[model samples]
Target: MSRHGRVLVAMSGGVDSSVAAGLLHEAGYDVVGVTMKTWDYETSLGGSGVSRATSGCCSLDDMNDARAVAVRLGASHTVVDIRAEFGDWVIDRFQADYLAGRTPNPCVLCNTHIKWAALLKRADALGCEHIATGHYARVREHGGRHVVSRGLDAAKDQSYVLWGVAQDHLARTLFPLGGLEKTEIRRLAAEMGFDHVADKKDSYEICFVPNDDYRGFLARRAPAVADLAGGPFVHSETGEVVGRHDGYPFYTVGQRKLGIALGEPAYVVRIEPETNTVVVGPRSALAERTLTASGVVWGKWAGIDGEARLGGRIRHRDPGAPAVVRQLGDDALEAVFETPRTAVAPGQAAVFYDGDDVVAGGWIDRPARAQPEASPEFVALPTL
Candidate 1:
């Protein structure tokens, strides 16, 4: 029914992507399924061990499932090797962020740089007019500008990680699973006779990091992280050395499992990577009213000037809070929350929203710092 001639779909060997490919093909689009080989478990682990399960993306088993689904749909499928790109863009950035005492979300990087950017290029080379994925998000064109919106299924919405996607690609991108819920997708897959992946479990762990043990992965991949001398945990308020830690790279901001028994519960307030030290404080000290972020990507509103009232989410699961966002410089913005938020960690994405639509987003540059209350003139408007 649609006008698209040839479409390239990124099949992750999961029920969602398989169903997406099927739906697109049934709708009269020439679908070509492509699975990206991001990492090899044996090579990443240096052959020390093999993964117990093959449920995650990029695994040998996932590729096979993807191929099978493509065959069933009567579509062509190919495996693209992206291991080198994944290592440099995702793995290296993850290790370096931790080494610099910041927690990094490799999934966000992978989705923005690898999944969409790299695949879009390949789609063009293969004479495909559009590239589709299984992400639970929606894209719409309003007033001739492409906008990214949250999926109809709130619980399964994946728009948070997709805010960094470039605006130009939005027109050429398709999210076939955006309007449907996970339950409905599974039901459709079953009806379509995709029983092999219909009941498959979703992967939550990082694909390259086996067993979800990031600490161990970093120790093996980047041994220099261990050579850094241990430092003392300094109390933020009292300014006294309370305990010692193995190394600063092993910890993250807002972490509570320091292994040191301070009489009162303390959380990591900030990490000083330059001095290899961690600042700890009581729970109350974690509240923050303001945060500065960099790498600002204005998804729909690209060139608006001055200040704007918006809802800011520091993490993916966060419900979001009212804030006034003001542009600080070319690639930076400062957001002051109406009410203080807790555990606003650095190196995490801070996405802004105008109702259900994603307005803009950026990476948190540092741990949340204390700031005075917002001025009355900059208060955010109430959400409808």
Candidate 2:
């Protein structure tokens, strides 16, 4: 019998997860480690057009490492193959979003729809009270609702990707590394005699697309989209076709290299699949003051009361910017940034935060060049 109760810990064979599992075990919890195999290395092709094994989280080596760590912790380990689910929910959405001329954040979708959903189901089957992972974010009860907050490690805070996690799932989820920094996690792993695990580098690429070449991956997966090659690259400011691009689907907003020499520096400002047009212009063209988002899931508050003062992070690496978010509908909201933000891509997530705590998040429908609609009830609040 354990003091805290049984916990199902997700171990990815990395130092953070390994240390997380060890910490839970040391804290007198009955830890059952699970290594989720979301992709197959033998079938997935790298950017080199070869099916080769790699050392990422999805590889067999990672599963083996996770099992070894579980054994050392005296915890039972299981390898769950969720590749089918992963492909259906994550991979298909990724390709579909790109084909629709939007930039999708697959990591957010995977963490919210696939990983947590799978873990909760597994935890229920295993008679575990809680499910845990190595994500660097904190979950707590605020105002009678579960809210996710930024981690202690600002550099590695993963709260941006966790915005879409449903409230019920957030209530049952636990992040063991929420309060610790990466250096501390590595030190803990080293002290546990897992020096190799401590030294392992973090995996940044998509699990299925190991080469970090998304353009190549798209071409290989949907060969028909290859026909979209030789699309026109139009200038956003001036109504002129500057050059031709390999394909509109292969390009994402904010990409600098257009493969064509434009006299001045250029960036991809927008993508239009309807006409197979890739809009390019100066960096100034990417700036947008208003953003409309859909598929919103509220965290800190059930919904925005009138206009809420918050900060919006358009991408994972964004430092965040002050914004006023207003609920447009049940599942949609509009955010107007105090200062125009550059590269506000559609299909990417726009996560709103109240200080360090997540307020709500949604997929950006589009960044509006126009200002917010004038209404009698709309009153501008002080900057967040």
Candidate 3:
């Protein structure tokens, strides 16, 4: 009990986080449960006002769920209005990246700029020395430094999205679900007399787009991008015009639906917003060995630099493969792998690692064609 400090728990009105708050409160630490008003998905969806937060974070329903948990646990709870911050840091970037035809990782941006930055600051103001969340990841400190580690549940590990976060944040952050699996977390919630979470299905949609329709959201938020419109969808090999689209931003790499069907099964290989073109290719072209990355954060591996070879997961679900990382410039790096990977889409994140430790990460750019050029300008990144 004395080993832990006062913790500010981030409640998403979900079982995992609410139970996290309960555990900390039961463990003798002063715990304040706080929910962030992270996004205005309702406003984007043409709702009159706030939609019922029954399913999404920061919704009225979510607020009630969080408030209910606080009352049940006899812990104080408050909601912080972070809508504007989330808008600038996450929503705006989401829109822009789509307009540019580069798939964006909004969760990564939100965690880096919103949760730890906005919410962590609020925790400090509330006299809390540590912050806790429902994340299914573990934190370990070794040799006077902190490292974010995988939780027991590999399928739900969110560490991939959180690699950009620093040790300074990890030192002050807590993951209550790190040790316990999802089933046990709910069981504890039920035992604590919390029925709201007895069988809550995990909310999985991009928090801002629950229905999974980003085009409608995009057209409303970025009218100019809509003006730019979409161009032709073409077969990668034959360059045959197969179909047309309203916007390339609406699609993702490896997406099959909403795409013009070729005689053979095809996947999205590239989306060039400049030409408003979507390149369709056979699955084989998706295999890529390397990715050039930018906007890196040295979360675990800080002093170690120069030719850092490690395993990598280009997207969250893919297995880590052996790869090498070379610093292109101060802010960018070119990553080459011993073997090729499929669907390594541009504009998505390619996170590097040494075993489980997140060594570094950045945005994946288009791979060099044919030659596998080791070094390009590693071009100075354009201001985002």
User: Candidates' lDDT values, in order?
Assistant: 0.82, 0.86, 0.75
* Clash-forming residue pairs, model 3: 53-59, 288-341
Model 2, 21-99: lDDT tens digits are 9999989999999999887565556444544446345677788888999999889999998888887778888888888
TM-score of each: 0.92, 0.94, 0.90
Cα-based lDDT at residue 99, candidate 1 = 77
lDDT of 3 by residue, 1-384 (tens): 435777889988888888888888878888888888877755765642325543355567877888899888878899888888787668777876776667778888777767887767888798889999999888888677787777778778878888777668888888878878877888999998889976877877677764656776776676666655457888888889888877677777777765467766788877766577888878886777767877777666564467877888888787778888888776678888898888876667888777777777777766654222122122221222
Model 1 weakest 10-residue run by lDDT: 375-384
- Candidate 2 — what's its lDDT? 0.86
Off by over 4 Å in 3: 1-3, 47-55, 224-230, 370-384
Question: Could you say which candidate leads in lDDT?
Answer: 2
The lDDT of model 3 is 0.75
Q: Which candidate number would show the highest TM-score if scored against the true structure?
A: 2
